[model samples]
Target: MDLKDRKRTTRQRLFRSFCCAWAGLTLVVRHEQNMKFHLLAAAAAVICGFVFSIPLFHWMILVVIIGGMLALEVMNTAVERVVDMITEDYHPAAEKAKDIAAAAVLVYSAAAVVIGILIFYEPVMSRLFS
Candidate 1:
């Protein structure tokens, strides 16, 4: 109601939001183990962007591909975990679901690889040749 109370409430809300975000990130990292690898790849892409002085557009594409792949992998991991939790024992439908989720990650990974090669190959090769 008062200015002081409003400021206090706003600070509390901001703290709560930060806590929630940290918790969510922890959950994703713990539950989706593959996230570590995706994160490593993203880090590598970022490093490459800086090292090569890639064009803005090229860097944008790299960021998008890396982000998209990581996002898809996270979703796939979540789906697989839920499905496994529902049915611990092997089942035909469960296998199909898990396989499909894995395939999605694989597809995204392949695309990311292609994009990486396209963006960096020339710069890399010229460095090597020189």
Candidate 2:
């Protein structure tokens, strides 16, 4: 296949790029267990936000946190896949690469948990305890 296929218009190129990004997200959601967990957590947070009637500003903060966590997870998956492709053998650097990628996901997940608690704890407590 020649690299010079029919030239796409700007809109076509942008749509194709969006399709590729969506495909990547689908692949990660299908294959990555951690992504599933993050999404589930996000869903729960959104539910709690509605149930508690959290402020719009709080919702915005939640959105940012969710976005950051999901983006980090996708990047971590990409890094691990690239590292594994580069070397299948037991290389120290390969191990380090995977470990660091995992650590990034861990840190984000932990932060998201803390923020979720901060956002929901008071409302949940008042509803339950009061």
Candidate 3:
């Protein structure tokens, strides 16, 4: 293929990949219990941010935290699915892999909670006291 044709093909492939990723994300949101909870929590955070009129820097931080959380959950689901596909029966290695993957999400989630509290505490308390 010529250079132009090759570029067009690459663009098509990139779009296809993105579509597939969106499909996977939709499936997770629709079917995964944890993903559902994360979506709810993210929505709540966004509403809080709007209500508090958080600053630009805080908005940036919230965006990063929310995106990181969703991405991490996707990754955790991917890991679990891969492990399940590899074995039908229980295996110690598979269990360890799943546990570690889940632990990563849990650890990041804990940090995100701390950061969220730090970001919102002053605003919340000020509003309450005022």
Cα TM-score per model: 0.79, 0.91, 0.93
Local distance difference test values of all predictions, in order? 0.84, 0.89, 0.93
Model 3 Cα lDDT, one tens digit per residue, 27-56: 899889999999899999999999988999
Which segments of candidate 2 are over 4 A away from where they belong?
1-6
Q: How accurate is candidate 3 locally (lDDT)?
A: 0.93
Give one digit per residue, the lDDT tens place, for model 1 in 40-130. Answer: 8899889988988899999889878977887787678778879989999999999999999999899889888988999999988888899
Off by over 4 Å in 3: 1-8
Superposed Cα deviation of residue 78, candidate 1 (Å)? 1.1
lDDT of 2: 0.89
Please, what are the lDDT tens digits per residue for candidate 2 over residues 1-130?
1233237776777777788789999999999999998999889899889999988888998999999999999999999899989988899989998999999889888888898889888989989998
Model 1 misplacement above 4 A: 1-22
For candidate 3, list the clashing residue pairs, or say none.
none
Error of 2 at 17 (Å): 0.6
Ranking by TM-score: 3, 2, 1
> For model 3, what is the error of residue 113's alpha carbon versus the real structure, in angstroms, after optimal superposition?
0.2
Tell me the RMSD of model 1 versus the true structure. Answer: 5.6
Of the two candidates 1 and 2, the one with more favorable TM-score, higher being better, is 2
